[model samples]
Target: MPDRKKIAVIVAGGSGLRMGSTIPKQFMEIGGKPVLHHTINAFRHAYPDIRIVLVIPEAHSAYIAPLLVSFDAPPSITIVHGGETRFHSVKNGLATITEPAVVFVHDGVRALISPELVRRCCEGALAKGNAIPAIEVKDSLREVDDEGNLAVDRSRFRIIQTPQTFLSEQLLPAFGQPYDPLFTDEASVAERFGAEIHLVEGEERNIKITRPLDLAIAEVLLATNK
Candidate 1:
């Protein structure tokens, strides 16, 4: 098989409003390092020579250079200004990539993504054109229908996570269409343009840290991993 370049787009545009912090949630410290540090490092560990693009708010871009230096960020890392919404932010990150390669779009606050999971996403994408990581929902789920609430079968629904990997050709054209409110994640955006994506088993430990309790839980998970 011909070698394909690997690119990772790490979105760090979170405002931290939910976490009750002045800074973005991805900048919060966990285990004496920024949460984004753990996330970027995971991709670097998985694909040592991969090119990485980080998208963050313009106001927060200045702080990232020093933070990246402190962590010795991947040699090919690039920092770009984010847009008004998640869709636009992702567009800006995608703009940095200009090759026919596989790309992984990941949330910066998801600091617990393991190297093995990273490889699984990229390799899956290589074979399937696109790959989305998802895990079975373990909790009971409910939904409000037109008439009233209903207990939905949790077994039928899965909790989706990142990094969502895709072949650049399959992804770029799909993103060419105008953004929609329902485009909550990369997989949705891809599917919005009629692209078929495969789902890979996501690791249970892979979680997005948004609330204060989530950061605490991530701290414990990090300790356990060590």
Candidate 2:
């Protein structure tokens, strides 16, 4: 294996509107720590020397240091102000990179991301050039149209998650294009950039904490893990 830098670009620009809290979802506490801290820790746990580029709303930047201090031992991080949209925020995060590396663009709210999954994504990306984590959709699906709603086959679909890993060469240039509403995630942006996406199994417990209920669930999961 070649010696390559591992970089994590974690985006957490949510306004906490969904969670109904003044604090951003990423800053919300779970297991006695901010969700964003857990996210950064997950990457570090996977690769202790991995570089972390955290993109957060400008308003929340001040709270970051205190949160890091809460860690057993704070790790150095490069913080960037988020952009107007998630796309722009991620673009800003990608701009911080200047070297050849394996980049994992992850959601800061997905605090439960496991070290195993982080390593898995890195390995898949290194072997195939890019790797996106996804899981089989378990719920029944419905298609709504002008006529009505119809049940669709859930087997053919997968729920995508992040820490979408890619080589910096492949991922960096993809964000160079003008922003589009269709660029929902790193995978979407890369797909539009003409890179074939490779999928790896994602953990079911790796849930994105978007609501109060999610925070509660995460607390339970964290306790169970311990």
Candidate 3:
């Protein structure tokens, strides 16, 4: 990749309503450290030289700023205020990168993302212009039509995960366009501008901590990994 700058934008825009906690889900702890801490650490472990942009709610940045100093190896991270929506939050992060590089857009609550998986995503993005982590759907799925619910082929569908990597040249420009309701993730946004998204295998443990049960599962998973 010729020493290209690798950057990761971790989006922590969730409130704790689903988790039923007073704190945001990302600020909650899984294995001693906060979920956002673990997430940022994963990227640092994968690529020590990578720059990180954390897009979080402006109100929460004060809570996280001091906490970052506690990291054994504090990373090159910049905190950006999150926008109204996920797409806008990502756009806020993307705006910081004016140089050509490889960028990864990740979910802050997806703290279980491993160093190995991060490497795979970066490598895939270096080869192809973009790489999105995804796993095939394992459960039976049904589609609703005018007739009624009908069985759908699960094999054709994939459960997408993040640390969605892309060449900044492609991504930065793609975000320049106006937002659309269908721009669910970086891949969708890139696709809107006719950029191809390549898929890489994602670990099952790379789950987002949205609910109370999810944090418990992540604790167990983190312990198992250790």
Rank the candidate models, highest TM-score first: 2, 3, 1
Number of the top candidate by lDDT? 2
lDDT of 2 by residue, 3-51 (tens): 7899999998887899998888888888788888889899999999999
List of clashing residue pairs for candidate 1: none
lDDT of 1 at 108: 93
**lDDT tens per residue, model 1, 112-204:** 999999999988998989989999998998898789998988988989999999999999888888989999999999998998879999988
- Roughly what TM-score does model 3 have, to 2 decimal places? 0.96
After superposition, which runs of candidate 3 have C-alpha atoms over 4 Å from their true positions? none
Provide the lDDT at 215 for model 1: 95
Q: Given candidate 2, what's the lDDT at residue 177?
A: 88
**What lDDT tens digits, residue by residue, belong to model 3 across residues 1-226?**
5879889999999989999988888998877888888898889899888899999999886667655865886776888999989999999999999788889999999999999999999899989999999998999999998889999989999999999999998898899899898889999999989997799999899998999899999999999994
- What TM-score would you give candidate 1 relative to the actual structure? 0.96
What's the TM-score of each model vs. the native?
Answer: 0.96, 0.97, 0.96
lDDT-wise, the better of 1 and 3 is: 3
Off by over 4 Å in 2: none
Cα-based lDDT for every prediction:
0.89, 0.92, 0.90
